[model samples]
Target chain A: MATMHTPQIVETNHPGHWKKSVKTGLKYIPLLILIFFFTFPLVFMIVSSFKRDNLQIFADLRSMRAFLPVGELTLDNYRAVFINSNFPRYLMNSIGLTIVTILLAMLVNSMAAYALSRLKWRGQKLALSVIIATLIIPGQAVIMPMLLLVASLPAISFEGGVIALTQGWLDTYYVQVIPFVTSAFSIFLFYQFFQDIPKELDEAALVDGANRFQIYYRIIVPMSGPVFASVAILTFISSWNAFLWPIMTVQSDNLRPVMVGLLFFFQRDVQWAEVMAYTTMITIPVLLFFFLFQSAFVKSVATSGLKG
Target chain B: MTAPTVPIEKSEGKPKKERQIIVGLLMAAPAFLLMILFLVTPFFGGIYFSFTNQRLIAATETEVVGFRNYTRLLSLSVLPLEPVVDETTGQPVLDETGELTYPRSREITRDEENYPQYAGLTEWFTFDVGDTRYVVLAGDPNFYRSIVNNFFFAIVVIPLQTGLALLLALLVNQGLRGQTFFRTMYFAPVVTSMVVVSIVWKFLYDPNNGLINEMISTLTFGAVGPINWLGNPSIAMWAIIIMSVWQGVGMQMMLFIAGLQQIPGSLYEATSIDGANTWQEFRHITLPGLRNVMVFIFLTITIAAFQLFDQVFVMTNGGPDNATTTTVFHMYREGFREQKIGYASAIAVIFFLIIVGINLIQRYAVKEKEA
Candidate 1:
């Protein structure tokens, strides 16, 4: 065995190693080309955002300089995006609402999934199947009626210590957060994960005189780190990236998310650099979030097939 | 011990059953309430709204007009009107005011001498009800066009994106250098918002100062002029398709990679021992192993393609002359832009059916293939 391994190591450093190395390197050419294909557009966006003028971007388009931060780069576009728009407000709205939504979703969806997977009761399977079936129904199919529903929903408001009853939930933060708190996809994912946990632990907890909720809170949730991470990342990305719903429901600038705020640039006189800068800014958070929870995100997508 | 155990177990079982029911219902209440309020109610409500004369601005009275919106949006099997003609002209003569007239008389057929102008009508289906004549032309041409556009997007994007994803996944499946870096970089756009992708690609497709045209010019040595990617109606949807494929290919790639990792390495070694070459091994082993994953990717990408809206909204706004107006986009425009809530609801209902139909067919196909 030692002798068999020695020749393989020796051949790598042998006299004709250069030829072997070249062959291996050549195999990666297609991969490099693909990487360039995927990365170049995003690189171009970042580079062009730094360029001062639309003319400058156009002038360098014929060469590799369009993707290189070579000449006349500045933060002027970023400055303009901050000063001339409600981008900061949009960013805050997205971050805050995404956090609130994720927290609520985790609490609510986990409980529901636990019940569906662990508890034995009448009509439990029927309820679980009914929830799963909704996954096939696209949101666009029901968005019209949802719009009408939200428009007529009862709400409560506080103004200067005076509480008033309101009829419509549209144009409110709850409209963005509350309706999405109990998604079928998230519940399904939790159910799949919860099924893997050992049932003997639940039996032990029950014998200890713990209630079902206590068993869940004390035992299952503590052991479900990976699932929570996956669900949190996926939910955060979606809520942050929500565009169509926000546009339909939200009319005020303060309530707009970052994705919808990109349209604010379009409504103005077309400024390509500022648009790129705004997109680049909004994209950085997503990239950061993705890199931080990269494995969990990939695992969630593979196992559950939920898209960000 | 046996006597006490039997009595206690019987006593505990009754309350346990009751408690299980209570606990299950209590835990699941929130999920059921939300789904019922949002998804189930709206699903049936949307279908109901399609049949009504509901306006966006609520009225004191909104009446259910049976099948009128559906007939107006799709084709009507029976149009209860007959042609009005004058004996003097014999050309289905106009009324006294020069209006071409159709009056309620008898159902007419395409075989009739003066069948209402079926000239240049591509979308028509006809069935007879015991010798009463009926010819169907599309009541709404734009809606039909939108459906065609949706299919076109799905047909082109699904295969291309899935193939690209599989190729990428295969490349990085081994213990290659910088494997994690490549995976993360490829998945960057998957995390990024669709709106951002559309905006960036819209800039790239700018006819005058766009990067794509400049690169094309350089590649061809100026033989090809800058193409109006988003401007020309013919190529507009194609531009959107390319951008969408780029934005979405990453998610599929990661999923494929996961699928690839699940295949046991022992099979490849066994194939090699049998003198199988690399291509042969891959063809026989890897492709067959990835069958289920490929079907999943196909179903998902196809469904997403059918729901194409944001890219069109952000990049082209369904224009230069509504070229990229997909079903969802048209529904949005009708509901929000034009405030034709009833008509838009009808579009939504049809869209729901189409999606459900596609998913069911795919599921059946995959099940059959597996069996």
Candidate 2:
């Protein structure tokens, strides 16, 4: 009787284990569905980018075959994007502009933030308040007047190997890069990060005969790598993805960024596959950057939310 | 040693203070200068321009119009339309389609001497109150439409995006295996440029031979349709909203995830010990814990919704009968495309005040909730 009871208990418990595993699997169903929904368009884009033509793209749209890299896959769409358009130039222009903006923004905003948070000065509070107050003014509000102002602002240009004074800053790299370098948001981010560092480090460096500049350079900056990384990534993404300003300011295709270039490409009577290829080309660099610095990217955005 | 040191310090202190002041000024100068040049100046310029007839390329000197631009933008009138009466029968006339017939709205709006306030006004919409049909007139009907579109977008998008973001945050925060992969996949759209996303979605929304319609048709066994997503005025704005939410929900989700992590785990443990279920834990703990994050996200999303231009410009160009026109898009059209700089500046000024008003109200509401 004892042996029969023990076997009965084991038999009941075995199915219970199977049921628990099934319940756990059920929990993942929603997550998997969402992942597929969110990632499908992008995956479809990349997969279709390799197809031979719009005919193939649409033909495969009704089946799982659309997502799979099959049925006459080719790099011709990518080749056509480069050969038929100014995409390569636009890509290069965007990269250069983004790099320059990030570097300048990091340097200038960090210095301002250091002055506000670490150094002793008169009116620092007022200055900081003024800067942060500007955050409420959305860029759209100023864009019209900004266009007029930049159009009339003085700039120097090299013409035929001779330096000449120019009246307008329009249709130039300077118009795109210079006005965006000194961001109030970047300064605020740096100020918040710098405020948490102990002031004793500055005092320690100062007592060792280091100047304020030296303290900022040696102690504060080196200690604030995370914040700097955050600012750089934030600036990189914004500058890379900039559209309204560049479209208004840049007219020359040689100076236009990838966003504007994509717009022009879309407006033309081009094939759908080429459009996908163009978009994929522009998106890869930013995605690669995001994946490489995933944690920093997430942290920056999260902190930005807490800024309010 | 003390006396010598004290004397030396007294001599150095004043100059040191001056030097520090100078250095601080130097450090802050570049950013301040740029801000003043690009931001402060343009802001004031916009305000000043709004009061004048400042064209982009001024053929004539800009004149101070003295609230004319504002009047043009904000003017409105509502009047009851009298249905046309049949001369022989002494009864209200009806059209062949069996609707009450009234005189054209243009005639009344065009009569400047009697309806001076409605001089430039056009018919925006008409509705009936009992037996009377009232027509809403506007100085700029497109502007009114843009405002309505912006509000409609904000109202729909704020709640939908916030709820979805919270759900996603919760899902990913459950310590599930492959959580990182899930989070990354969800966030992939946020990193892509709005231009690219808009274009990609435009293709998907194609009326014929598009993926979305194909899927819908297949699922319904070909009963539903080849819907013209963007070309249809009624559905165009909704299309834009869906794409915008998809593109943006990830950022808010990341914020919520961070907020979720900040909640103490011990609260949940205590709740579980008291026999609290999943729904109860979420309602009591998760919702309250996310209040601040929700407020922040709501305000930001609302502000962004008001500034909806990129997708409209790319996909619709405020087309399909002006259905998707936004304040920013309208301003861009007036200011840049039409060269009506002063009028657009007026729009910009109003847009700025609205944003400021929103921020103030949000701050007050959040503070009240906390208290």
Candidate 3:
């Protein structure tokens, strides 16, 4: 009777453990589905970029082979993207634009935020309010008038070792960078971060005979790394992905950023693999940046969402 | 001691305050000047331009148009269409397809002497009430369609995206292993440029050789598809919406995750003690906790939906039949493509008001809920 009872207990326990495992597996099904749904297109893009040509890319789409790097892969698509098009120029243009914009935006917006949060002066409140009020005006609203304004504005340029004054900012690199540098949103983000920092640090620096600029440089900026990181990431993403303004303002292929460049490439009848390669090339830099600053990016987006 | 120190501090602070003011002014100058130059100037110029006949190239002298652009954009009229009569039977005529035979909409719309209000109005659509078929016409039917499309996009995408984000947040918030991996995977597209996403999806949306159709075909054993995703007018906007949602849902998901983390675990513990199940706890605790986040996400997504342009421009170019033309896309087409800067500025003004209206309504609704 004891032996029979022991066997019965073991038999019941085995089934109960199996049932719990099954339930756990079932709970993960939704997550698995979502992961697949979100990642499949991207995976297909990367995989297809390496495929020999459009024929192989499409042929592989019929099965799970589309997501796998299993076909006759070649460097030809990437070669074509580089050798056959102006992709290299666009890539360099985008890279230079993104780095310059991020640096300038960080410097300009942070200084403004520093003044607003740390210094007490007459008219500061009014200035801050005016800046904040402009936040409601979407970029799309001002774009048309901005085009006209930029078109008639005077620009200084160097031509053949001569300083020449040119009318209109159209089709210029500064046109893209300068207008976006003074972002209200970036200033606000920096202001919020700066305001939370203890003012005692600034006072201590001042007691050490530091001037206002020195206090801001020595005290405020060092303590504000996270916010600076956030601003840089935000600016980098926007400037790198900028489309509407670039497309509207830039007509020269040499001046076009990667986004508008991709549009021009897609508009032309090209092989699917080449398109994929072009997209992959443009996307890798951003993806690498995102991966390195994953937590900061997530935190910035979360904060932005909350504030909105 | 206090009196002496206070006087000494005051004596030292005056010049320091003056110096601080000067420094602050200098520090703030660059950003302020640029804002006034680029943002404030352009904003007012846009409003000013809307009242004048301002072209990009200005082929003629600019003149004040006095609300002509606004009226042209907003004008709509509805006129009842009388059915053609059969002379012999005195009965209303029917077409061979068995629909009511009415006089062509153009004939009535163009008869300016009798129907001056309807002049310049093109037929938007027709509707029937009782036995009367009323033709709805607009001065700029394309603009009206763009507005409708904008609303359709916002209405569909806001709820759909918010719900999906919430669902994803809940799934990832469970403290499961490899949650970071899943989160990173989901966020890959958000980091990618919209242009690249649009181009990639354009290929994926190809009617014949697209992966989406191939997958569907394989799954169903080839019963459906090779369906024209972007080439069909009716399905084009929907295709864009799906792609847009897919591209953007990750950011909202991150927000939802942050909101989820803010909810105290003790509430769930307490609810579970009170015999609350998973659904009960979610409804009572999670939803209420995420109320502020939900309102924020909803407003942002709605604003973004109205600003839809890149995808439409890249994927469909507001076609198969202008089915996907959004307000911003329309503005771009008019302002840049057609060089009708004045008309585009009017669209811009209207777009700005709509955004403000959305923000105000959300604020009012949220306040009401809180009360």
Candidate 4:
């Protein structure tokens, strides 16, 4: 038995094992090719950003040298993007807006979702259905009137360091943040997650003299970490990536988001390398966020129930 | 088992139910109010504004011009669109009313189409009778053109993106090595802004120095001249479409992969036991399994296609003579750029109706499929 075992082990560990390894590797060739196809644009974007100019990019387009980090690499493009453009301001604006939007959205949507899903109320079914129905209403369809509405809506703002009532929401940070805070999709997500939680827990909490709000605050919200994270990430990504509304509303350079600031590069001369560098910078935060919560993102999107 | 009786706890909780109703309303109030203010109001407001001649910076009084904008967009006429110039000045002739007049005749060999001059020269309706062609231009050619472009974009992008996504999902659904890595790579773009994608693609589509043309030239051994991707009107929309598909296929792929996982392995195993080939198994089992997901994806994609704005806005700006102009792009231009709020509102209303119509159809289809 010992002799047989030794021979079997030796055979399994033999140099001829490469054939089986190669066969296994061959199975992944299609997946690898697809990965390359999918990732090449981004890879090219990063690689080409480090290149000197458009001419260099064109010259290296055909060869393996295009993808390699071998060229007249310089920080000049990055320097130009910062020095000549409002990229920093745009980034700050987006970050601030995204944070506030996500926080408010989480609170508001979760509260609403809790009420709709957990609390017993009159017209609860109707309200939930109405909220869900709004998912089908594409933002493009209502943007025109929304523009008009925002333009005419009253706002409170600071003038000369004093609080003042403003007539319109045009060209302001509040306009960017406020309208997006109460998201129906986020609420729907919360509702779905909250519905899955056991009603017995709520009943038990109630029997212990806990109110609905107490149950929600102490029990439900504490337990619903995954859904909260999902909503927060999705909401943050969306608000960060907001383009059209910001463009329509925000005219000032200071309030512009990174997506809008991207156009600043185009309005001037077309510096391909610099533009690429700028795009990479703008894309990095989203990519990092995605990588960090990749599974959560996939899960949230899978359970999103519907899309816009 | 206890006898049927009102529990003392249940009797005491009567006020609690009332309080619950009040609390629920209070909790849901802010979101409901915001939804009304932001979404529902605008929806009705769009319809209201469509009938009025509301300009952004107009000093004049706003008046409801019933059906004028819609008719302006839809009206058509058959006329010989010939310029009347001064004959003595070696040009065509002017009428007695001092306005340029076309010599209108039924016997004219060539029939030119005409529309409201605001619609541009794009509107044309052609009919041929005994080798005499009659071309009639629609009132708002731009609107019609945008609709055409929207339909074209939808028709091309949906199937291509969905098919590519389905293929990726199917491939990755296999228990392959580095599956998560492949998924992450595929889904990376879904997290990025559409504007970023457009900007990157725009750089790639540049006429002289873009990588796309450069790669194409190298692939063909310099036999083909450098193709003007965005510059050429014929290919600009397709360029945008390709980029959109790239950016969007990820989400659809993820959805499909999730759908695939939900499918019971036992079904496939049973089919294989019956000696079913891969294609046969896929057709009978996989396709049917993914029906709901496919329908969902189809609906969302169709809606997205109609709402194609960000990429077009960033890359083409409805440019190269508006060849890539979509419906939303047109609405944006009319409303924001041109400050024609009322006209744009009409477009928005029509777009809403179309979207509703599509969703209803989708719902009916899903229901029918289940039935």
- Top of the candidates by lDDT: 2
TM-score of each: 0.88, 0.95, 0.95, 0.89
Give me the runs in candidate 4 sitting further than 4 Å from their true place.
Answer: A1-23, A302-305, B1-10, B13-15, B77-122, B125-130
Q: Is the docking of candidate 3 incorrect, acceptable, medium or high quality?
A: medium
User: What does DockQ give for each predicted structure?
Assistant: 0.53, 0.51, 0.53, 0.47
RMSD of each: 6.5, 4.1, 4.0, 6.5
The digit string of per-residue lDDT tens for model 3 on A1-308 reads 24535654676678568776676688789888988999888888889999998889878988889999996889888998888788999989999998999999999999999999887777888888987888888888899999999999899998899999999999999988999898888899999999999988888888888999998888889989999999888888889989999888989999999888888887784698888989998888778878888999888765654222
Kindly list the per-residue Cα lDDT of model 3 for residues B281-351, writing each as its tens digit: 88999999999999989988988888888899888999977999999999999999999999999999999
For model 1 chain B, the run of ten residues with the poorest summed lDDT: B118-127
Give a tens-digit lDDT track for model 2, residues A1-308. 34535654686678567776686688899999998889778888898899999999999999988779999989998999999999889989998999999999999999999999876676888988998899888889999999889999999999999999989999999999988988788999899999999988887877898988888888899999999999898888889988999888888889999999999988894599899999988888788888888888988866664232
Of 1 and 4, the candidate ahead on DockQ is 1
Residue A75 displacement in candidate 4 (angstroms): 1.4
**Each prediction's interface RMSD?**
4.3, 5.4, 5.4, 5.8
Better of 2 and 4 by DockQ: 2
Q: What Cα-based lDDT does every candidate model obtain?
A: 0.83, 0.89, 0.88, 0.83
Better of 2 and 4 by TM-score: 2
Model 2: lDDT of residue B296: 90
What is candidate 1's CA lDDT for residue A54?
A: 86
lDDT of 3: 0.88
Model 1: residue B129 alpha-carbon error in angstroms: 29
lDDT digits (tens) for residues A1-308 of candidate 4: 24535654786788898876787788788888888777778888999889999888888887877778887899899999999998888889988999999989988889999999887776788888888889877778888889989999999998889999989999999999888888788888899899999999998998899999998899999999998998888787779888889889988999898888888666685888898899899888779877987899878765553545
